[model samples]
Target chain A: MPKVEFNVDRCKGCELCAVFCPQKIIKLSEGINKLGYHPATVKEMEKCTGCAICARVCPDCVIKVYK
Target chain B: MKVVFERPRALSDVTTHYCPGCTHGIIHRLVAEVIDELGILERTIGVAPVGCAVLAYNYLECDWQQAAHGRAPAVATGIKRALPDRVVFTYQGDGDLASIGTAEIVHAANRGERITVIYVNNAIYGMTGGQMAPTTLEGQVTATSPRGRDIKQAGHPMRMAEMLATLPGVSYLARVAVNKPANIMKAKKAIKQAFMVQIDDLGFGMVEILSTCPTNWGLQPAKAMEWVDEKMIPYYPLGEFKVPGEVK
Candidate 1:
């Protein structure tokens, strides 16, 4: 199992991470973040491979993956 | 029990001012990761350019100096010469590095200054509202080039990596991109290598990153990345233009 954390406020809603997630577990949140952008959130935490692909593609450095 | 992916210590906690989908944040993180891995965070000094990354100092957690437009290489040269023991680097954009700062960069590379330059070539100028830069592709429409770039009037786009590689002073030169996971990894490695060149006192090293400007390019973030692959890469070509100890 792996853990992924998101710094919601730092996210700019680019969705690059969500698009790159190999497991397809990340998605934009339904609500807006402080920046008025829908920050990414893990849809199914269990499906996350902790591959850190999301972190790699994120432009905001908002995602942290622990394996 | 381990942090597999986390913010590099060399990066500040504050949020960046880059627009959504801007690759500047990714490049900054890559550079910070390199600095952290090399343990040069304290000894490293970054010179910020006057373009979109002008506030680069705010995001990077290290000693920084703001350089005038297109003068980062000149400022970096002064810093590196004054403090040879310290690792000096410059973060510049196409407008700052390729256009206004072309002479400065060329001379610095020719002189083989022991400094690292991270140049972002997004084709169009970002901060100045999407104007055609020196690296803008032919027939690419920007705010200034509304009808697409007219090559006859604008001339051909500059290939700084290839141009600088021809100089004997440059010990390392590579062009990379952050459009995908694999490319991002390669880009990080190249950045590390560029910094290592300076750490080893090799010579001038530069990594030209083909970045995207979603807001300016008038395309979705993902589409802009694809544009880099379909359009920019064809013209720019990603690979090592030069490296230390390699046969010419």
Candidate 2:
């Protein structure tokens, strides 16, 4: 299984990662962060390939992947 | 667990001030990753331009110099000449480079300065609000050109990579965009190659990265990324215009 971690506070809630995710697992949290943006989080970690595509498209570099 | 992808050491942990969906952050990370991979952080000196990316020095941990508006190439040239052993590069925006610092870049490339240049072209002045830039597409509405950019008055958008490729001193010149995941990988490769050219002591190398300004473009971050594909790419096609020993 692969793991993806996000510095949620730094996320700009641009939703780019969610759109680019191949597995369609990342989603915005129901709550907002300090910046008042709905940061993205993984909904189904088991499906992630750890391709880092989410991280690559992130304008804020908020995600890191481990495989 | 072993780390497959993480932040690059060459990039500081400081949160950038770029607007939401702005691709400057993506481009910055690519450069930092290239610096880390090339093991040139210690010798890398970057010249920061006067635009939205002016705060680049704060995010990139390299020893950086602040260049006067539209003089990043000139400053980079001076730095490379003063420290020939060091790897010097300039990061400039479309407004700063294409509009204000055109002569500086033309001369720097013609002089064959052994330096890397990361040119971010968003086609609008992002820092001081959305103003029409030298690379703005024809009929694109912006703050300065509310009626849309008039081709008669503004002329066509400048294809800087191709224009700079004409110089005999150029070692490498490529135009890459950061609109999607695949393009991001290609952009990283191009940026790394540009730095390699400098390290190999080749002539001036530059990578013009088609970037996004979501706030200025008045579109979602993702849509702005698509704008690069649907709007910008047709006029400024992506390709390696020049390569060392390949072009005359």
Candidate 3:
């Protein structure tokens, strides 16, 4: 099982993870959340290899994955 | 193969009170590592800021002083002026340095104070419920800037490293990010260089590290680093902004 989750309210919309990810699976949806920022979305769940590259690059420690 | 990543000898064994995934702990380790490598544990005195790292003295194994909000640089100035032989430094955050202590930093640099400043720029006020800090990017929304940071209303994000580099009294200034391994290595080198500047009895030196504040920025730790790399980097580019002996 692979789980991807974000504390939606905490997204700063920096979009670095999506840019740095080898798979490029992460994307920021135009949809606004409660925090009103364009939070990132895991658009391609199938492509996620759980390498945790996004986790390593994040300064806020907002992403978590379970494999 | 086993690698030990515990606290450095220059740092105490006490666990940091920083939130999980907070980069302050990593920064503390980096500074302590530099202190250990330079063998200035006994003679080093660190002045901590009143932000999230206010209790830094408890974690670092050396002489430490607690300064008021944004006053670490001023306190460090006094300490270094009195004890010219001791290596003195100040650990401050964006809110501390770019905001409240702006005048103190300017004067310190203008006077060519021989001290190192480890400036952590996380964009928002980390410990203070994610307020809009002086380094917060334009259009970036914070608790105080829910409608997004307007350039007209908020002025602009202050780039301390670039600003300080122009000061003639400043001998070294570098801006680095800690969002990944490569950048982290670069950041460590920059920090070491700042310390070495003081060790050589040079004038003011500072290493501004682009850090992340997940809790404040409302992003997962991973996304926060990404933001730092993408948005923050574009505004506050990384690399050595200033150094004495660099061939143009």
Model 2 lDDT vs. the true structure?
0.93
lDDT of 1 at B231: 96
| Tens digit of per-residue lDDT, candidate 1, span B105-197 | 999999999999999999989998999998999999998888999999999999999988999999999999989999999999999999999
Cα error, residue B24 of model 3, in Å, equals: 0.7
Q: CA shift at B77, candidate 3, in angstroms?
A: 1.2
Q: Which residue runs does candidate 3 get wrong by more than 4 Å? A: A1-67, B1-6, B246-248
Model 3 earns a TM-score of 0.78
TM-scores vs. true structure, each candidate? 0.98, 0.98, 0.78
Report lDDT (Cα) of residue A34, candidate 2. Answer: 84
Interface RMSD of each: 0.9, 0.8, 8.3
Candidates' C-alpha lDDT: 0.92, 0.93, 0.81
lDDT of 3 at B20: 41
> What's the number of clashes in each of the models?
0, 0, 13
lDDT of 2 by residue, A1-67 (tens): 7889999999989999999998999999999998889999998898999999999898888999999
Scored against the true structure, residue A43 in model 1 reaches a CA lDDT of 66
Please give the ranking of all candidate structures by lDDT, highest first, separated by commas: 2, 1, 3
Model 1 CA lDDT for position A65 = 85
TM-score of 2: 0.98
